[model samples]
Target chain A: MSQFFTAAVLTSTVAAGIALATPFLLAALGETLGQRSGVINLGVDGIMLLAAFATYYVALRTDDVLLAILAGMGTGLLMGVVTAAVSVTLKAEQGISGIGVYLFGLGFSDLLFQKLVGTPLPITTPPQVGIPLLDQIPVLGGMFFDQSPLVYLAFLLVPVVAFVLNHTTYGLKIRAAGENPAAADSLGVSVARIRWSTVLLGCTFAGLAGASLLLYDGIFQVNLTQSEGFIAVALVYFGAWRPSGVMAGSLLYGLVGAIILTWKSLGIIPLSGSDLAATAPAVITVLALLFVARRFRQPAALGKPYEREA
Target chain B: MQRPVHRRALPALLAVAALVAAACGSSSSPAPVSSAAAPASVAPAASSSVTPAPAATAPASAAAAASGATSATTLKVALVAPSAVNDLAFTQSMVEALNSIKARYNLQVAISDNQFVVSTAANVIRSYASQGYNLVIAHGSQYGSTLQQLAPQFPNVSFAWGTAGSTFNQPNIFAYQANSNEGGYVQGAMAAMLSTSKVLGVIGPIAVGDAKLYVDGFCAGAKSVDPTISCIPVYTGSFSDVSLFATAAKTFVSNKADVLTGTAQAVVGAIGVARADNLPWFGTQWTQVSLAPHNVVSSQIYNWAPILEQIITEIRGGKLGGATYTVTLGNGGETIQFNSGFNLPANVKAKADELIKGITDGLVNVPQ
Candidate 1:
């Protein structure tokens, strides 16, 4: 048992877990804010993909990680705006529009990946910065301080988001608009503007999440994130529509991801003939979704199409 | 009433049209061409290139003997690679080999990249066949199933699929794999020799038939080198996932494996972690010495060029008709590259050289 929890192994495992969690956490937190406004933006996944590919292209060309990250965020903002235009402004069927966004992003990004980087090209990312004193702390040092600043920022955003949603006037209006848009509109809240802003901000988070995935990690592949967007969607429900709950959920998923790594690393789980271990995250996410279903409470107007006229 | 009068005339016109269509279908097999006319007529340019010409245009027997049975002046060969042609390794080797044949036989060649998909294979084959290409080479195991199904559809064209000889047996379908297992086996042997501990590890892609071949040969090669050696093998089920690869690499390190090898296209992740951990590593498909400048001790290189060159030359000479052709070290098909860019110890290099010579001299055979 002690061997399983050895200092070196445990530290590295936690480091890796955090690395894996960064993308999901970033996207889920963003979606949480979007959902609070009663807009279920399934387009988060598509937005992340466009950002991931755009990040790869910019990073490869400019060799500037910051510029590449900005490119990803820019793409994400565009995706958000498009989704906002269709679902929030036009009051289109939110679910169908979201699905359309997903399909378009998946196929279009793949075409882009093929066009830009037809073969594997070497990529170098900015070095991860270690916080001075925090990085020196034995086990915690490697786990928390050893990560890229993006990982720290993902965790930090959770509290900041929670504060905004729970304490700010903007947060109260978003809740009112999501629950009863007519009430908020009659109160001169500009329901359309609030939803659009939330959608854009949510997608900006998603774009940064995607940038973390591409530049923070060593290399890139076409459609590499696979269905991580869906995983982010599931995280929103599992968190029960709260920023704090969402972070806890992300940590739960991240821990499961870590366990799979440790188990396979320690040879606790025997891999028969193939590399099925990589599918562990998807399996774990599905099982978590099943466990959390009994407690799910969706917003009342989550998917309802709003209209000005009766 | 006026419309009803015109309906009778419309049926009469339709009946005449149907009669003509039925007559055309029954009188001749409407397959665009009759079997009575040999395929040679479909591409008169193709048959004329190989046939004896007028005395004035004919080259002397000396030129014919110099090139070894060059009946065809131009053997049009089409090659389809599943990956990019400029990989500078696996795909590049095949393309380079084809270029050599093109240079030698003055062969008219068409090379298209399938870019790793089964759907792309059929289209590439069809496009090349329609252009009257004499030989089509589908390079990659994924193309095996599709090429087998597509081979008979174009009888005038012959195909050579790479990485699996399973497609062989159809007269027009040929298969070639430059003995990848032999290369895998050599890598395994090198891993065993390089390991400080008696344990070694191999991480490969999901076990398709080809992957299983590499795994089995690797185990055989490792055990052959040291009887007490323990070989740990795992698969990540994907060809390009870095996180999964990192997990596998850490697992190898945890198991006291001083040396690790992986066959993932994205094995750089494994190699990166291995280098960071200061363990020796081996790789397959490409010379990835640069990936882990500190830990990648060697690689089992797939030089598919020779096999492609051989197939093209044989098809041009009217002598290459087999369901499959297997080439090994005995045929100079694959090579094991050992470079000290990984900062390998002097003894390790010496042992690697001995093994290289042994394999070359037929004294040591990395098991099939």
Candidate 2:
């Protein structure tokens, strides 16, 4: 317990928390965009799985992080297009269709992995790039600045996402599409187009999220996402579909996860209940949702497929 | 309007169906490849009377002689694993063991990996048995119930499954388990002695089966070295969540733990964390030194070759089941492999060696 109070321990915990949060942040921010446009994509986890495997495969073959990331994003784009085609163009029920996408991603990724990489092989992770002056700052520097390029980009996306949603014509159309797609359609906005684009954008971010996770550990296996993708989608509701709120929710989750682990390590939590301690993040998420559910107004036509007049 | 909806929906649904069919097609294709490699000599009736030549027969002669006139009597074994054959963990250990004894017994080995789903595994197990394989090994504890039900149906084929001790008292079923606590004790003793902060962390997959035994033994071993040494054991409640493992490992490091260890496949994530912090890591189930040579001090490798040999010998002697095999320090079934890359202290290595000897010699009784 005394060890938990030390400066070094606190700094590392913060750093670890950020590392854990980055994947969720990226995925949730993407989900936020889609939800704002009224297309709910529950297939984010599937997207992440396929992207993670694709990214790992490319990185293993080419040894180029750029190409690997592009491969990951490309996989996501492919999956995204499929998802859009199903829920948007085909007018299927969004929830059930998303599950289909999830199962496809899950099974397809496993199949591809078994066929391509039958065994676990180590790949070099992208090297960490510390900020010049910022990394030298006592505790905060190491916690925030001394991270991989992916982490910096995930955080950067937060503000970029917030600005776009509030201040742009495309963002306005997306919001309009979600809140009242019929009205948006009446005003010459293509509701289908807005929803399809938003879903695709969400999936692309999900793909990037997968690549970030693969880069973090440098290994891929079956179920590597471990439901982080599902949690990211849920975070959309937890954050009220707002980018800033999503970031806060993601960080809270990351920090809580880090704290529980740290507490268990220091014996601050009893060994007997360690399994229960692992459930801290999920329990907290549920409680946060319950607290905010009453006040939140989700998009009116979030899951409805828009069919323009014939 | 209806026609347009139908046209768009048809192509989308067809695309999804085609993709799903491709996945199923690829996953199902491995089964036939395994079944196709089945030896021609394994007659359906011979499976019931699979009594190999006496143990005194030179095992090398068996392979050569079997290829000639005795091919009808050669052992054909099928292994169904829950994960990839080369997961570098539980499944891999059995695969390597099977490979080791393949040539000596004139054994034809067939492997079905990634059988995480029980129904799929049951079908595969039954398929192997019905195909007249001499011995079918279900290499996961999750398959225990399935094996219990299936073992009785296949009276002619010898059944082996583990990471467990129960054989259902069946005549044709063999059970094997590792005395993992023995090696865990040794690892804990070394970590206790070498930890600079007197803190050690154990990232367990779940508190059941061998995982529970290993964690209990590890804590006992640490306390034995220094009664006050802080040994924290945490179960992530999952065996596949690499992110959770990494988080747990980082937390341990953050709390000033200079030594860490974990079990199961997820330990790869924990090992990566240990490497990043330059902390010493102890491993179990397989040799993990390859994963992080610089940080992995030692690994308790599960050498199931000896056990496999014994099982084969018994099957040859017409004694199929009603027994259990345990891998311990005394038997060559489990051995602690120290990493040459890690600069372990001389005294710490000596102490670890002494502990191993003591456990093997019955002077040390590891906690259950």
Candidate 3:
């Protein structure tokens, strides 16, 4: 309806939609790379949280945004490696191990925040920077062009990820490992190394997603990544496990978020029904999963742990 | 020997390196909390002196008091709330209050935000207890049952909470209740008088006990003023979803409602709708009027600083936790703050002032 789909509403919706999608896009794209190397990281959410709280503390202590982001990435990489070592080397269940990593990261990061900042502190975040010409264009300008640099990176990552996965030799080896670890191992490829590296790379992206949220929101509150990790998981499936598809998925989710925000901003949708629209991303992801399940095939050894015993 | 050297030292070195790298990262600097609180007893002193209130940063006095009361070397306090510490409204206020107390009194405080997960509640308590926390305070009404169960095991540690008239019997556990409904009633009275259309709407999160107090108090306050006023209420059953709050607000505005009030945290969405539609609204807990300066008529502000400072002072003093302390209008626990810049009608201000006096005097009872 024109009432819901007004130009102002659409543009704002797209902007907010992208903002909401950055975390999911970054996490899912990272996961896609990991899965390609036969490593499934369910701990993406936990890793994001670890990065978020760590970044918050570091930023609070040092007042450096770049350092915070790097800290987040490093935390994510460590979490990824832990999950990878247990699942890839020890042959532990990937899903279970990833869950453990998530739980640990959440509790550990939260404790660190409590210890450092003393529960709640009034901290001010950096202002978002925009390019000169693009940021001033009415609706799209403020929404798309005048965003935090991480949002643009999320979009840039889609093609970069596609190029890496589809064209690069490392990408080929990762795919080979995911498709048939034993065959790849027979070819003298260290399946363990590939899986560990992929998971760490994915975790770094996940960490970036967490950083985007804290940096953009201007404050780091508790449960800062509430269900965002689940959304990232959903994006992986929504994108049909492809980098381009994941980007589309993030856009769709971000679009819904932006629409609800814009519609409310314009007084188009009544306030009572706005919560339903907020549920749109999660619901759409579920529905998209159903569609993808029927249309596409998941990697053969997606969740199975790789062991060298045989 | 070679394997042992790589295994033992490398991971330790990496961990240390990671810790150093992490220590260097992050953005945003916090303002020093010198002016965050002005003691309740003191007059508005000089403008720029960063003196935190006596209730907030009286560590020397608290230390003297604690030494007189107990021999405990470390005073540990834990915060377990239904929502995250960054909720920015109810829970955030509590967290800030507790942290201020901790900083002033030099008490060790641990906070568990999403302890809304029932399984995690007991686990969190046990972990904190194992670490020898002296006092634990749970923020939401939902944690009443959880606190009751855990208080016995950690008898040496005191547990306190804000619940709906819920009490803990353990020598160590206490409850803290506030005159929240009184604040709700004031907003109601304000919204009732300010409405141009005499039709008001409320978009609440859920139909819970505390939320019901807000809704019922608002309705009662409105009815006390205008016998012929119509009030609409809707519970969307969620707090985090802002779009829903907005949609409800738009509907109310579209339906000729000129005033709105709600208990939903995401009610910011609803306020945005009100601002865009040019209808005045009221908020709760924090000064949400800052969101839409023109549209927000008034906010019922809750002063957690007083309650927090008092509890911390009492602990530092010779007193073991008292049976639940309930703050009322007479005690300056809660008050309705109007946008002083807004030129509200004289009659409206007079009626609100009269009601506040009556409430403080116990002549008027706000419905809960």
Candidate 4:
């Protein structure tokens, strides 16, 4: 236990926490955007599964991380179109329609994996790139700056998403569409168009999240996402549908996961009891949700299909 | 509009319910159910005796007798697995072993994969037994209770299960386990000798059964080689979360572990991390060399054909269950396959071979 508290162990655990947070951060940020625009895509996990498989398949064949990521994004975008078609064009209930998307993504991804990559194979992950001056900092440098390029991109998207949600005209239109679609339509905001675009954008982020997770380890398996997509969706509620809040929730979940592993390795928790430790992230998430549920209000039109008054 | 919303709510509720069900069933601990009370009509000697009286003069007994009278018996075996048959981990190991012996034993095999739900598994097991299959192999520890209940119901049907030691004192059930620690000890000894940083890491999926035994043996082997060497083992509390395993591997690497090993299907993630970093990796349950040709050191392969053959032979000869079997390094059931692509030092290779010989010759005892 004494050996586990060394600086090296602590630093590595922090760095791992950041790495572990990347997928959740990316997916939650996307979910935040979708929910803010009055759409809820519960199929985020299924989309991640499909995207992860696509990324892994491309990486195995071409060994090009960029191409693999594009493949994942392409898969996500395609699923997004289907989701929009069902929820936006057909005016299907967003809550149930998203479940259809989720099931489709889950079953289709598993089938494709069985038909194509029948066995688990190893592929090369993206190389780590340390930022010049930032990586030289005392302890923070290694934890934040000395990460894979994907990790940097995921973090960068958070601020970018926050800015887009809070300051842009499109952002205002999205909010209007969610809060009161009839008024937004009367104001010439094109509610359907805004909702469709936001859902697509959200799914694109989910796809990238899948790519990041696959590239982190350079391996792929069925059910690889392990309900992380659901957690990302939950983070949207936990964060009050705010980009910054989502970031906080994602980081907390990721750090809790890393801490549990570190604690078990250090013998702070016995091996037989480690399963209880594994529940820390979910328990914390539930507690956070309970605390925040009373304070935050969801978009008025969230999970409701918007129909133009004839 | 109101009707549509109300109808949609049902599906939305159902979808949430299904997701919750999946999450709950995903990695449930094998429930401990006391073995079913023995029925007075069934004789305990039915499993051990060569020429026992037929306990059930039913159609199932007639079918069994008819099959046994044929010189080339068509041995029908059904396997219930918790994950996909091609998971490339525990399930795949058994599937491959069963496939290898199918043709030689005149076996007709049926598999029910992804039966993570215990109730679903119970139904499948009973279905197979009622269909008069010669042997029903419950391929997961989670199926112990289901097997115990179903084994006694179908007195003529021979049942086998494991990574467990107990046969429930039933004559018709065969329990099989792997002495995995023997191979883990050998791998740890090799890992300790080869590690330059004198720090070894193990990523285990759920600290129980073979996973726990293997990790314990690894630590013991590493400590015996060098008391000062750091042997850190972490359980990810999941058998399917590849991302967690990958993150754990990166943490280990970050902390200066030069040699790494892990078990379960999720270990693909850990092996990927090791391969990318050029760290030596040890594997168990299956050959993982295809995942990392240059980085994988050796794999303790589970060769189940020998045990499968023995169980089939026993069932044919009138011994049904009341017996336990184990696969070990001393037997051909468990063999160490070194990755030919990884260039190992001559002395290290010689030492590994010597250790294998020492264990097989009864010179070394591996602690469980």
The window of 10 residues in a row where model 3 chain B has the poorest summed lDDT is B26-35
DockQ of each: 0.11, 0.48, 0.09, 0.39
- State candidate 1's DockQ: 0.11
For model 2, state the Cα shift of residue B154 in Å.
4.9
When superposed on Cα atoms, how far off is each prediction in RMSD? 11.1, 4.9, 9.5, 6.8
TM-score of candidate 3 relative to the true fold: 0.65
Q: What is the lDDT for B253 in model 1?
A: 73
Candidate 2 per-residue lDDT over residues B144-181, each given as its tens digit = 99989988898989998888888887888888888899
Runs of candidate 3 with Cα error greater than 4 angstroms are A1-5, A129-138, A260-278, A308-310, B1-80, B83-114, B122-139, B144-162, B165-327, B335-368
Cα-based lDDT for every prediction = 0.68, 0.81, 0.67, 0.80
Q: Which candidate wins on TM-score?
A: 4
Name the weakest run of 10 consecutive residues (lDDT summed) in model 2 chain A.
A119-128
lDDT tens digits by residue: candidate 4, B110-138: 88776666898888888888888889889
TM-score of 2: 0.87
Which ten-residue region of model 4 chain A has the weakest summed lDDT?
A: A102-111
lDDT digits (tens) for residues B144-240 of candidate 1: 7777677778776888876775654676776765566776777777677777788877777666655566776777778878978877577766665
- In terms of docking quality, model 4 is acceptable
Candidate whose DockQ is highest: 2
Candidate 1 lDDT tens digits, A1-310: 4556787777877777777788889999889878888898776777787898888788888898889889988999998887787777666667767776775665567556656676555456667789999999998997789878788899999889999988999998888777887778778898889899989999999999888877644555545565677788889888888887778777777766666656654556676723466577677767877787677767766776455444
Q: Which residue pairs show backbone clashes in model 2?
A: none
Tens digits of per-residue lDDT for model 2, A212-241: 998887778887898899999888888899
